[model samples]
Target: MALLHRAELRPSKLELLAGWLPGRQWFAGEAGAPVSRVAAYRFDDPAGEVGVETLLVRAGDGPVLQVPLTYRGAPLAGADEHLVGVIEHSVLGRRWAYDACGDPVYPPLLAAAVLADAGQAEEYFEVDGKREARPASMTLTGSRTGRPVPTGPVSAGPGDDGVTVVRVGDVELAVVRRPVPADVPAAGGLAGTWPGQDEPVLLAYAR
Candidate 1:
């Protein structure tokens, strides 16, 4: 696939945040909450459609949460709607931003992040690399319980109907075919007692 050109993006990262942050599960702002730029930065991406951002927002109370989100076009089915947002990239112009769990370029990007701690020789990438795509998966080891997470289907391999984990030394990158939703709690209260009750009412991402 052809990559997007960088010359098409805008210069303001804050402007990107202004439209991006509210749609995150970790965001603690009120509905349509006004975000006063606390701090922010962008990530490098080989593919222009994907935009990564680290944002700090002082919402209601406690210190700002450093939210790292990978934005791209469209929402991952069944994900919290907050994960999707349209931002004008300094290079790719207007594009959606969300998690990189399902993106093809993520394997390489992920490899870079993991290799920083695990060493490049120990990093790996997984993809289909064909006309048809299969699901993608990832395993985060720092977590207390080290387990694999199948991120769902990705592009199939060159001539195969399935995907492959291009291994690196002892490290193996397996595409998580199915992602488990984080244990989340439903919103409480009948109606009037809820906070931010007077906003563009929708389901809140509560854990």
Candidate 2:
């Protein structure tokens, strides 16, 4: 389960994304337009050390962008290239955020989710030392692959058709960087939905 805290974050998530998104090669938004977060989902780290989350956001009427982020108490060794910048959390103090694609802890968990046909992790909020169930703003569904989950560092590279390829071992997983029409199928991979959406949107597939 993923536990959320009702606390303030210095610079905030959106603030950080606003400054960082435009510099990304895949961002389709107007450089100066404001960005709005549509929805978000979380995945729990089995070890409970890393916080994983994916955010769906848009600038104007441009395509919805999928950004997976990982939060850690300290800098992840060898992940300087993926750093989104450090920020201070009101409840957790300082945090280091990185693009999930480059985080060593992310790919294996994501592959496991796909192979197990799992959804996003359940969420809870702490209040008065008690945890309360919190509904997720977004939902994810993975397709069973039956293959053993791949391990090792993931190397991300640009793929054909605008997808991002995350290589684990010798297997390459293609991640849809932008939201596509609902009629499109994700095949044997992953799909997601946000509130008010009638159909699951394709997110990624094994390649």
Candidate 3:
């Protein structure tokens, strides 16, 4: 039988978010509400330097806002145990665990994800929320170095009122443009199969 290297769930940053999301003014949940998880997915970087996680959370009475996060294992000065699990990656064969979005290698790792999918090239990065900051538009950026080569012209997808869609190669990521409520069921576990090498949706972002 094939070995199943599943993610060991514990009190993660999700615990912090459980209390924080309901307090935000931009939150779409009801006044004084609750939120929880619905499903999630994990992706391994082709280069084996980082890991990407997308969480599909169903906030109370609101639309599901997809939260994308990156993980790294290099010990950060202040991260310590807050970095979640430090298990050996089945694919990478190295033990790693840390909030990767803030890792110095995040930009290139993310850019690699984009380029590997035959999507856009080096655009830019962003920082927001309390956890791993997010990457905003592709046209804006101050960092200019090519770890992941850009392939072609960037394209847009059908975006909703608060969602932003960007086409990377053949994939479409729907990024959340606005914040929403935080009252909902907790994510029981991550869902969906591993993303193929080239799928139409690299990630569907939310806020």
lDDT tens digits, residues 1-207, model 3? 011233443434455345545643335655434556654444445565555654555466775555555556455565453354444554434444543333333333334433333232221222342233223222111122233443344444336665545544433434442323322112111112222212122232211
- What's the number of clashes in each of the models? 28, 0, 24
Tens-place lDDT digits, model 1, residues 109-136: 3333333322111212233443332221
lDDT of 3: 0.40
Each model's C-alpha lDDT? 0.37, 0.81, 0.40
Indicate whether candidate 2 or candidate 3 has the larger TM-score: 2
TM-score preference between candidates 1 and 3, better one: 3
lDDT of 1: 0.37
TM-score of each: 0.36, 0.92, 0.40
Look at candidate 3 and tell me the lDDT of residue 180: 36
User: Considering every candidate listed, which one attains the maximal lDDT?
Assistant: 2
lDDT of 2 by residue, 1-207 (tens): 999999899888888888888888888887767788988888889899999998898866678998889999999998898999888999999999998988877777767666667668889999999999998887787877677777776788677776777878766777777866544334357788877775888777776
- Name every residue pair that clashes in candidate 2: none
* True-structure lDDT of candidate 2: 0.81
Worst lDDT run of 10 residues, candidate 2, spans 179-188
